[model samples]
Target: MRGSEWVPGVQAAASYEARWLPKDVMAGLVLTTLLVPQGMAYAELAGLPAITGLYTSILCLVAYAIFGPSKVLVLGPDSALGPMIAAVVVPIVLADGDPGKAVALASVLALLVGLFMTVAAVAKLGFVADLLSHPTQLGYINGLAVTIFIGQLPKLFGFSVEGEGLFADVKGFVTGLGDTVPAALAIGGGGLAVILVLQRFLPKVPGILVAVVGAIGAVTLLSLDDVDVVGPLPQGFPPFTIPIVTLGELGMLAAAAVGITLVSVTDTISTASTFAARAGQEVRGNQEMAGIGAANLAAGLFQGFPVSTSGSRTAVAAASGAKTQVTGLVGAVAITLMLVLVPGLLKDMPQPMLAAVVIAASIGLLDIPGMVRLWKQRRIEFALATAAFFGVAVLGVLPGIAVAVALSVLNVFRRAWWPYRTVLAKPAGVDGYHDVAQYPDGAHIGGLVIFRFDAPLIFANARTFREEIRRLAQAGPKWIVIAAEPITDVDTTAADMLEELDEELNAKGISLVFAELKHPVKEKIDRYELTRTIDPAHFYPSLDDAVAAYGQRERDSA
Candidate 1:
């Protein structure tokens, strides 16, 4: 029972209600319908055999059921990860053109990613999931969506395009346009239309499942020999086996694993947070990381690849009234039964139909509305998002992730480097001093400057602070009183600058005072002995107190 804190599924089972059993069973069956086609589709998308997707789905679901904290979050192979996986494994396998080697490399990559995620969870590093900022993440995903849609174009039209990056893929698609098979195009186009229409109008119907069934039926009835079918799947459940790779390949796979783990953790945490809020459950972030790690590890061990939380699948399960992890377990069992008893069930399913499934999923991944909102609200953030998008479109998927992360980090530094600084003035009928830019008619006392610097006094912006103060000093004010409420920190470089600036000002018959400086920053000032050079009496607890003191000093002098 004590260990149940770590193993949440055990706790859930202990408190299981009888009424939930039927709901879980039904939801699991419904979930399986959507899972089968998607699993096969995403597997092909990842440059692996379609059957491996089922193995990944089964293993990840079962493992997540045991270790996952969220009751409704679903773990599986994802459309977003497909290209990333292919980017890593395809180049390596291109030399030998062995499907077996590709699978092994991908599995090893999954194992490494799982290990990294598990270690991070233990270290309580769940906050690292925010590696991708919202704007940059939006751009990267949009770029990825476009790349995937183009990559799948040749497949959707019944030909194969072999190229890297967006431009090359587009060119290959164009060059191979003459080889397009009409039957494949019609079936694939019709399948995509069916899914889009059903999903748009009839939300409850499993559109992917319907499209798959219809395509298979059409192929079988019409004897469509021009189309490419999935053929028979390997029989039985995935066997437990350790994926191995050479020492030379280990480093490259590990690098890919880091990117995969980052994306997986981000996706899982966000998905879990959304579903948990709807379910009225708290998000245990660290526990969720462990759950994701366990699922990936399990999949990697069983001839499968890395996976993440699937928002679409979870939505389906929740809509169907899933009550517990039992739903996921049920889905896993059903997939296992299908593999063992009906291995050739989807043998007649057309490859173009699979492309349609992936293309539809890719379309969903785009956030056009979100991109438009970013552009309208904040142009700088829109630029960041656009840069991230181009990073993926111009460079490869892996490099694009690098670009997004770099841009996010640089954006943070950019803010801190030149944060907003303004002059504050007390306006008529206002409670306190406000930005003078917003109150041009605000009153101002002679020989007093109420300046505000809206950032920490770090080394990055110390020069900027010095220049702003010097610029204000040229007006010949007797005192410059900083509205310090927003100045959260006073580093050593800033303290030194303050001492020098105060001395320089005093030499010019002007003084510097601080009001509403936070206690922590004051403590740092004292630690740096800044008060020895600058007067301690100049420090005031609030803006009002500083103004009163200034007025009193002037009256006494008069």
Candidate 2:
């Protein structure tokens, strides 16, 4: 725990001052009011009891208030990370119908994740989260969204159906169509409709909350206890207890830990960064990690599942003029009070309405505007986006996330396989050699063909570079100059291949020249005696210098 924290060791976050006006007390209430039901809905999405979400929301805020770097960001139970937790927990619970055992396993998993994140924070390894690129993340989220919607359909329709995968769930749902409770269905459908319509028209109207309340009121007035309520959630102050897990359960929970750690850290850090960016405040990635790390650990202790940065709720806090982490503290206190005293109020809340809230939230994450922007800027990126979108929508979440990740890896390989290599030429008034395509009919310095490879020289595309050089050399070019500015590092295989090419060029009396080599790359060449193999004089700082030197050498040879 950071010593500067107001709450001592319990606190997981650090603090920063807002240069402008700080967040007001009313703004905190506005965000809290929005978050109370959302936390429950997201908890249901995570395959945990509704109250676990409430516990997470409260504890995370308290933890973040103590340790959070950003004042405007709110930490809570997030729908985005829900599918991942469900994917991990459902299989385990299906095998053993013990809800207590499932909770135990999850608590242990959450604790481990907290420790992992805290360690990562101390090490300043926050950037490791970026290993999964944006494209892959998009695909993962898309897939999860579809998976969640499919899984929640039964709850939405007020039917009890069981299936492991999306297709199986859909099939089971169809088979059990007759069991749908009409009242629950009405609440679900109406809640979804109202939520969506309000989001579109009334931005600050608290649509989800209103829909939930309306659904509850409708269910109560119409006497629909025949349709299920979430039941009196295990409410009151969180009891302090250490998570205990057997070795077998721990082993089973490892994969969940991996998935949760990634999702939790990604959401938390991104939300913090987004809030900080909007407020023109500096963000500390390590501090954010520590905040989230403590939140997860606190949640685990409080019998809550894993928690993360809630994007929608964070935006709410930011928009509500939350100037400091105290807003989160206030929100936590508010939720705690709701859980302790008003537990009976939520006893008859409809499951379908919760499902509807989740559905409404998840659908909005599709990012239509972002896709449009990407489509106009880069068609290839747009294609990747479409692939992820459909892949999640149709194929399901697990497979969709898998496809997105695979696509990202493949994208990297594709660029490496056919890296941008351009032939350079000197234009009429340009300072040095530039890409011929970029210049208007630029001259090639009288038989000197200069080529620039824009990526690192490695085994993946070294052959292509070699082949192009040989072809250009054979095109009656007396000298071949490589503009090595963008080419950073070279592998041993590339160096060996270059050596072989150098011998071939020497025999044909065609000079191989290199210009503008980065110091690191130049050092590699020097270490390998590449400069000895090819004359040291051939190397120059500028393309013009190389061309002039080559021309002078030609004149001397003549």
Candidate 3:
């Protein structure tokens, strides 16, 4: 393997330009501002201590810089993964109520995810990222946004509410409404407004950093003793450790890990593609998987949880003039210094402010415009998205992911089982033959019927194809010419059906023929011994050729 394929950072460092240092350093310093608050908030969201988020941020940023292909992409604790982590860890930890156990389980989960992704990268299985289709992904994210927003409501209001799922959380929040703290509410609500307003109007500004700093100041100055704070963090860096769990628990963790890997891989690939396009670089998908896996593995070894690419943080870095991975290296160093020198720096930071950070991220995940666009363009895809949305929002995160994958597969099958079948006719002044249903006024040849089936001919659709051909035969045309361009592949069952159908039609003084059949599919027909009943001479390279041959035969007879 090429050195750049495995360790892209070394290649980048070897070719490092001196002029990029200042910009990278400045961007790194600016990124630190947003990273601190977001890391802590996402850690809490994952049902781990706030400090673990910092550990995750430091480790992932450093590790990705070494192994990642993208120069400016940032990796850290993500808002979307919070509920997924909590879903897996909370139930297992609640019984013991040991924070240590919770951290260990989360670390192990991270290890499993890292292992899965790394192996997939080695096997070049990056296409598994397509397991979640676009429409379903949009719905799943929308549902997750609702789940995260609802889950944080109690914390945002400066209280604790416990429930199992979305509805339970909603009920818990409503029941605990009177327990709201005014000071926490002010800080959370105000911070949310400030971040949203700045993001909308002044996107280049570090709005999250501003909100976090402002909240810290308000809490310290106003002496808001009533508001809950994160308290002082543990000092220094996390020591390398192996997270262990029971064998029985391993099965459950593995299941959740697979789901998390899917989400993480999808998120990373999409984000990498976007930034790579902007920078005029190619997306090395397998390398990207390896990079993400390395980051997760490093974090898991250091008592940190799973991490994914942060589009918002990457955008912040880019907007701040990031030119290389050195930017992330700088951010990691800054975070490590803060952990080592002053763990108490954010002791006065209000918990509500953290809630606001998460809520704002959740709001960004909504994608209502995409939903509306899908509905306008394709109702079937819109339905798939809706199913996926309800799967995540109503059923739960893990189950919702399952629903999303199932829906994508089933949708593909639905199209194959009953594909669009149409007849073609030559319209006036048109270059090619068009669908008869669409061009009803077009003229059809007296003795020829042109049929089109818009899907691959496979076992699932073989019967459907045969039935459609029979129906078209009712027109009593002397020749039936199939526009076979859309039929990209013909499976064994479909080839067999074609042989039988051609024999049946030939018995009725009619001939069956294929026009514009792909070379690959034609090879399959010959290999399947379909030439015995269906004449090889009946196949034409083009529809016009087939029609002209029929006219020539008629003229010869006259």
TM-score against native, each model: 0.98, 0.92, 0.98
**Predicted candidate 1 versus true structure: per-residue lDDT over 85-134, tens digit per residue:** 99989998997677689889889988998899889988889988787999
Model 3, 1-558: lDDT tens digits are 575569998899999999999999999999999999999999999999899999999999999999998999999999989999999899989986776888889899889988998999999999999998999999999999999999999999998987899999999999999999999999999999999999999987888989999999999999999999999998898889898899977899999999999999999999999999999999989999999999999999999999999999999999899999999999999999998999999998899999999999999999999999999999999999999999997889989998998998898899999999999999999888998787899898898999999999999999998988888889888999999999999989898898889999999988998999999999998899999999889999999999999999889988
Q: Candidate 2 — what's its lDDT?
A: 0.77
Q: Supply candidate 1's per-residue lDDT for 269.
A: 88
Residue lDDT tens for model 2, 181-208: 8888989999999999998999889888
Error of 3 at 310 (Å): 1.0
lDDT of 3 at 242: 92
Candidate 3 regions exceeding 4 Å error are: none
The CA lDDT of each predicted structure is: 0.92, 0.77, 0.93
Error of 2 at 55 (Å): 1.2
> TM-score-based ranking, best first?
1, 3, 2
Clashing residue pair totals per candidate (backbone < 3 A): 0, 7, 0
Candidate 1 stretches with Cα past 4 Å from truth are 1-3
Query: What's the lDDT for residue 42 in model 1?
Result: 95
Pairs that collide in candidate 3 are: none
Residue 380 in candidate 2, Cα distance off native in Å: 3.7
